[model samples]
Target: MATQPVTTRIVLASRPTGKPVAANFRLEQETVRDIGEGEVLLQILYLSLDPYMRGRMDDAKSYAKSVEIDGVMEGGTVARVVGSRNAAFKPGDIVLSHSGWQSYAISDGSALRKLDPDAAPITTALGILGMTGFTAYAGLRNIGKPKAGETLVVAAASGAVGSAVGQIARIFGARVVGIAGGAEKCDYASREFGFDAVIDHRSSDFASRLEAACPNGIDVYFENVGGHVWNAVFPLLNDFARVPVCGLIAHYNEEPSISEGHNQLPTVMRGILRRSLTIRGFIQREFVDQRPDFYREAAQWIAEGRLKYREDIVDGLENAPEAFMGLLEGKNFGKLIVRIAQ
Candidate 1:
């Protein structure tokens, strides 16, 4: 008889008060149950840790439902089918799944997308070739609408989504300026990702540096890190400039309530009114219709050496919480992934 599998998982131990600590999560193991007809068993290979997972930790309402207390922390993963009762799957297939932070998972064919490892590394299924890349493409095509010779700015410029956003905008003929949190990331964004200019958000004179970088004004601003970055970019947005409000990692750890000291609604409203700005917040799923086009074009760009990406991989499932906490602090250099298994 074959040995049965076991799954190790991290669950939310409690809703976080502010920045999530390791105490907020608990790890447990369970014997894997046999798969029923139409179900497949998966051994997770990689787990993606993105900034938006912070919002899911809160009890507050948003675009998606909050993960219930003690539920597995939500995430996207790449896995290998270890066993299968589903007619459409086999024991050796690689797939993309929403398997959360677990070492293994059970899936019905419904939620698994088969992956071609020969075409790209299976890990890319959780990063560049997956939702992260799609988010950048959809936001640019549908909202930012970058035109040739226009200037575009993206915050967190060396990140999974922001890197893709800057590169795609450049491919569309926009002049791309990136804002990153450190000198290292700033240099990588400009040197590796091909941003026309890169600004270090941590610089003392960040606002003035940003203004100097985009002398013609910003035609598009991909909003990822908000707060101070938004403040600097607001005054530079040209009339009718497009702002795609994506993940706001800068404020994710704060208490949900707005503080009286930082209220800038009046100034923001006045700016919007004066400039006729088109600021739109979007969830990537809303642009599902463009996924095929995105996959085709992004793959072509990667093949042509016009687009690039990087990964910051941690070695174990146990380290996810710490790695995630660091991600919010801008400590991650690229797409953050936890390699759960070989």
Candidate 2:
């Protein structure tokens, strides 16, 4: 079959000093090149927008290299294989690939995983059954270590990772308390996501409210937002509590050297020493060897209706920058995704 000649992509137009603005991204169209011997042509369907991508915008030392100026912004994408020069994939095969911010991409197939659209919605390969879900499982299981009857608190309660952390903690018989930004999200956390208690972090009485909700003291705190939310959770932690330091969306857009408020290191250390808490920071790739187990268990829970996920999908690659900016402001309600094509 003949392939289309052109592809559309969003590239990094410029680096941002703080929060990323629309000017930082540029959308352009270019001709698609023929696939090489072991490569496949992918038609991107969904693009996953995660908080960690914010760090990649800056040219600094991190676990991964920063996206260079004028380069295509990086992300996980679910695509349909429209053409293949390889034996492993054929036309119409949906696969998970790091296809970045383009409508069509060429891949060598080594880093791509074929998907069964019949098994689950193809988009899920970028969400619940993919990297995001695995991140939640691996972090919580290895660090949070929720036990039966224990209490687990998670922020960004409606996001991909936080939602998964809450549900998985419940499966292990922990009482889950979710902290979200607004009343609607708080309701969704408690009513839809099965959280034992939901607190609106935007409330004027946020710290007091969180204290009231977590009467038994927090045993496991899945740290997603690390600003005011962290300040609130710190004092509520019980002795021997476990905290898995995940994404810190609250400070993602801020300049690395800027101080948001008065230093609280002494207070944090005091709590750590007094309560003997265990805090561990992690990146999802640390648990790649456990992907098989995570996928097996997470898929089962999703299939059995024990795990529920919500996706806030925006249309078009042009809207990605604005949608991503909203993500930092807690404007998104759930797992954020971009539907680039049908």
Candidate 3:
């Protein structure tokens, strides 16, 4: 009998209380089972680290189940099939699979989508050409309903999702204003993603700056970071404005705080009533019907130079924990992905 292959992987060591620390995750080696009928053996190449993963780390009830203790951490991965018992895939075939934070996985071919290296870089499967991009497309088209000449605002503007949101809104003939931390990200959002204006949310005068940037007020606001950024966009929301609530990264790791005027709930409700705002919260899977359309159009935009995507790649799977900690602090410049294999 031959020895089974060993795969290196990371798993949840403990549920985090506040911000996650390295102690929350454990790196270990496990045996890879021999290929079973209809299964493919994959070597993970890239693993996406997203803000929503933070929520999954907790044992709280959410749209998705929490990662069990000592279980593999959940995420999307781009991988290459190393061995296969399925006719749909072959050795050396690349694929997009949700194999989580691991070096290898045995997939049953049901949840795997083959990727063509010729189409675009494989890393894009974990980012721009995949779920994040679909998130931006679906949120804007379905819930936001951007209109020509309307001012559309997006927080976390330099991210994979937010950048796409800004560009797509602009393509819809809407004026786009982006809010991001620091001057560098603001410049990139304005210059690279075609945002009409960009505001630095880190500034002491962030609210005032946001007000100044959106002279016509915000007609469509993409809410991804729901702390002070939402506070600034609140009062500036135009009558009948549409808001699509995406992942609130800012509040993901911390408990929601109560502040001035009993915090933002009263203000949010007031704006909703006074302006007749339409605020809809969504999980990307709800709009999976539009995936084919998003892929066709987003690819066209990428090829035509109308859309720009960026990635911040961390070199090793061993570094995923550190990189993820930085992600919570807004240290990553673009889509954060961990390179687990060559």
Count clashing residue pairs per candidate: 0, 0, 0
Query: Per-prediction RMSD in angstroms?
Result: 1.2, 1.5, 1.5
* Per-model TM-score versus the true fold: 0.98, 0.96, 0.97
On TM-score, the leading prediction is 1
Candidate 2 regions exceeding 4 Å error are 1-4, 255-261
* CA lDDT scores, all candidates in order: 0.93, 0.90, 0.91
Highest lDDT: give the candidate number: 1
Q: Which candidate model has the greater lDDT, 1 or 2?
A: 1
Write model 3 residue lDDT over 1-342, tens digit each, in one string. 257768999999999878899999999998998988998999999999999999999888899999999999999999998988899999899999999999999999999998989989999988889999889999999999898999999988998889989999888899999999999999988888888889899999989988998888889999998877887888899999999998888888785452334555777788799999999989889998899999999999999999899999999999999999999889999899999889
Which wins on TM-score, candidate 1 or candidate 3? 1
Looking at model 2, the pairs that clash are none
Instruction: Estimate candidate 1's alpha-carbon lDDT, on a 0 to 1 scale.
Output: 0.93
Ranking by TM-score: 1, 3, 2
State candidate 2's TM-score: 0.96
Worst 10 residues of 2 by lDDT: 254-263
Supply the TM-score for candidate 3. Answer: 0.97
